[model samples]
Target: MLKIEELQKRIDELLLKAGLPRHSVNLCTAPVGDGTPYISFENGKYNYIFSERGYEFFRKITESTDELLYWIMSELAYKIAFKYELENRIEGRDGRRIAFPKFIELMTKINPLWKLKAEDEIKKTLSASPYDDSLYL
Candidate 1:
């Protein structure tokens, strides 16, 4: 089972790899969705929100413990999430930092499977735990 704290660490790692400061993830606020693991970023203009369908897929991979399966699932999840970010647009707040949408898009395209795989792993662990809570995005 994946603990929330561990999941958070994985998230932080992804954010760092994505070129987003690790501080961006607000622990005080809910990161994942109602039933899925989703993240939302807001600047001055628009809010960047995305779901973690990849996480659900990840849980399946982890359940089996097949490294190759896990790798493939992880790769796919990140690709889908990154693609969503890329195709979408976000309003930049200060005009200095890259808008959340743009950042997501760029990260996804560069290493679409990186952060996403980690996120999926965490989400899967969360869902499988005894205290299961639905977090659908």
Candidate 2:
């Protein structure tokens, strides 16, 4: 039930805030779950991980975990997305998804090699399943 409009709405809500809790922080990415999305405080910043418990998410084509994680991220997520201006990164069929590479860059402000670890895992799952999210990935 998640839509790009919804995601943009969430991002817009945060943009109204003007800033985040930490001026110097990174929203790092990793294949923490099976693309379920997770929020964890690591090092000096918070990590917004594309999550899962393993392959359960990969095996089924169910509701979008991206929405679930955004929910999990709560207001802090709003602030981060607001800080990075996630509204600009969203694109897909009817604008329903976020580009993964730019998403990683928005967090780490560097090449998205770290996202590869997570992408590799997601790639394997998508490869085995009937789902082909590469267009959105």
Candidate 3:
């Protein structure tokens, strides 16, 4: 299980790095589909929800402090990109569009090693397993 305090700290750091208000972001648990975690913005607060399986996945990917920080930052980038699109804010406050390519570039610039490692971890998780029975369904 991941420590809530640690996760919250990482979230706060990511928010700060993204030029967002730390007070506007929150970490919480909620029911999510397919074990995927998601972020929600309501009442001027951004709630990051983690399902049981999502938390487990997070724990697996974030084995160290540095890894955890990188992962959270990457997630923040993705969420920001999505939010920009949803709100039709193609040009952010800095007059630059926040897109997936930019997100990836930002992540890589933050820590190339950590970003590559994160990608490998995700790839491994998404790869098919030998014990596959869902195909029958």
In order of appearance, the predictions have TM-scores of 0.29, 0.25, 0.42
C-alpha local distance difference test of each model? 0.40, 0.40, 0.53
Clashing pairs in 1: 33-135, 34-134, 34-135, 34-136, 35-135, 35-136, 36-135, 36-136, 86-105
Off by over 4 Å in 2: 1-86, 89-97, 107-113, 121-137
| Higher-scoring candidate on TM-score, 2 or 3 | 3
Clashes of each: 9, 7, 0
lDDT of 3 at 66: 64
Least well predicted 10-residue stretch by lDDT in candidate 1 = 57-66
Cα miss at 11, model 1 (Å)? 0.9
Candidate topping lDDT:
3
Best prediction by TM-score: 3
TM-score of 2: 0.25
CA RMSD of all predictions? 16.1, 14.0, 11.7
Q: Rank candidates, TM-score, best first.
A: 3, 1, 2
